[model samples]
Target: MTNRTRTPRTRYAQSLICLLFVWAVMGSNSALAELTIRITEGADAAIPVAVVPFSESEGIPSSDKISSIVQDDLAMSGEFRTLAPEKMLSLPSKRSEVYFRDWRLLGQRYVLVGALNRNGDRVEARYELFDVNREERIMGATAGASANNMRTLAHHISDKVYEAITGVPGAFSTKLAYVTRDSANGEPRYRLQVSDVDGKRAGIRLESKEPILSPAWSPDGRKLAYVSFETGRPVVFIHELASGNRTRIAEYRGLNSAPAWSDDGRSLLLTLSKDGNAEIYRIDIQSKNLKRLTNHWSIDTEAVWDHTGNGFFFTSDRSGGPQIYHKSSEDAEPRRITFGSRYNARARPDNDGKFVYYVHQRDRAFHIAKTDLESGEETVLTRSESDESPSVSPNGRMLIYATKQSGNSVLTVVSADGGDAYSLPASQGDVRDPAWSPILR
Candidate 1:
């Protein structure tokens, strides 16, 4: 019995040691750079689409072309192969100007044409998507946003175009919450940042001299919950993006970490060790009511709600090594869900309830793997040796996770089926703990 108890304890200690080592070596004297995205892999059967460069009104300020941004968004999804504007025989910003024969000859299946016009303090986009094979207009819309929000408008157009082509909704407009670590003046600094799914237009939400980890987004996409070490100990805080207000949520005597929000956003599932050993607990966000969910000597943490919201998936070490488990309710016994690996944790389930994704260790390398809930089939989804923090897009069509690229930590996005990959790498320092936000209303 004593030996059984020591196994998980020792494993946790080793993990902590590795984490500390990573932090110690991540110190850098470089300023944070705007995340640049690169397509690492593309699907072989990607649909060929052409986004004609949008004609901008003379008064519109020079910026990234809306059609170009839309093209990049589709290309990054790995589902679409976008045609370069320079290779196009003609640039048409309207339906009447589009010649179906020209696009068909170019081997394009679909074409998107758009025009941007500047209004008083605002920019209006008129866009249309056409099926090249059928020579039919499938989608069209006119959207307007503040002149400074052209990127947002472009993302909205991308989302509409993607949904029109595929049955699944596009996640281009969704936000990603992550942590960045760097060194300044020989002291380490950590920042919690939120950015577009493509890793553009990032804004820091919080900055501290200590560490920040496990950022989780609220269901409504308005707030973020995460753990911080600013006070010399791990404490959970809920930050409101609009107001920049932070409220202390959890500061128990011992470890406070891994904040996962409930489906309704009324409470959060937290890892707290105040009761003696690390365990999972659900706390009400309003009244601060706390209820223990897992009663075990082994460490139980990283809990996430299943699609149905009646059950949850969490990581536990009761079976000797960390593995994924699921419980139907707060009092139900957790059923082990991962056996292919000696170490697996951080279960993120899709909205369809078809699969649960987590970090799986095979030999000495860690990669993101997903388990088919019904068939019990497990598939490793990444080739990276140091992958962690898997966050599925709200639509379940794409996934973003942290991994090492050129020895520096970065975030990579891949299709849900593990086809194609694009990476968002920081110019300096290390980025980790990515949380994909739900589609905003």
Candidate 2:
């Protein structure tokens, strides 16, 4: 019994050492930063708003300024145009200090004011959202966070402000899962990282010398399913973010890749070549029971569940070139969905199943495009040269994908309607295979 106890301690120490090494390597290299967001172009009709600078009380640290991060989050969404502190006529941190007439003259539609107060070890933010035209406080709340988690508190405030105005839940507090490649030390090193949606405070969830791809977040956003080549052959592993634990869910003969979580989070739809050709199969996560969904000799992969949970949309090369296809059920036959492009694959539908987005080939250049399920109209959404792996935001307002610019691969987020776009580039390496986490309630 003593020996068994010692063995568990030894394993815990080894795991801790591995994590320390990962954080050390990541910290020493500033180029491996949490993504830096750059708004390439903004929407023409963005809502005009002002986020007043938050006044901090004495004895509290700046510890990631709350107001600045909140402003950036709202601006990055392409939904709001936030006024700078310098341009504001008055810096008000409370309702009593706000002047409605001055804000009306500035042509602002809405204004957010807040102040940070420190009590003991916790920092609390007292914030209010108001409509300039109506001269009413639309929302008010107090949110607190630990001293080390000010960024999270700021994002939470952003989410609240967003939901109150847009009627859609703010995805600012949600996380993003992506793969970054850094070969600075001669041999290549890959890291699977999760960070805030605005790209701050990123932490490596997994590190390897091998390649990692196709990170899909579970419905609850607590776990990530990705393809790792750590075992010589490709295998799909489900990794829990809170704990550094992972389980190899699929390792078949030819290919076990492109793991897509179902809406209920009970199973995953993956591509496997064990049965002869690349085909789509569903495996119950706990029971490990396999069910084949597609038997096509052509490639049938990149499957994603529709919001309805009754059907799925996937990519296939059945119609000579790759195109989008949808199946209402397991036994239902797939019908082609994309007709405009010769190569359109990786279909990701919005939460309401209104638009299906994919990588589209236009004028010999790859761009991200979406097709309206109701109107049967397809509109190209990106202007980049090579864009792929599009992942939609939880609110269906924005979608992110991997694109190449200036010889480096960067992640770009564009408005769902192709109105505005921004790029998140690493300081040194290539960032790709972005999967936006679902909104955690």
Model 2 CA deviation exceeding 4 Å by range: 1-33
Model 1, span 81-152: residue lDDT tens:
999988999999999999999999999999999888888999999999999999999999999998888899
lDDT of each: 0.88, 0.85
**Every candidate's CA RMSD:** 2.1, 9.9
Query: Using TM-score as the measure, which candidate wins?
Result: 1
Pairs of residues clashing in candidate 2: none
| TM-score on alpha carbons, each prediction | 0.95, 0.92
Report clash pairs, candidate 1.
Answer: none
Please give the lDDT score at residue 436 for candidate 2. 96
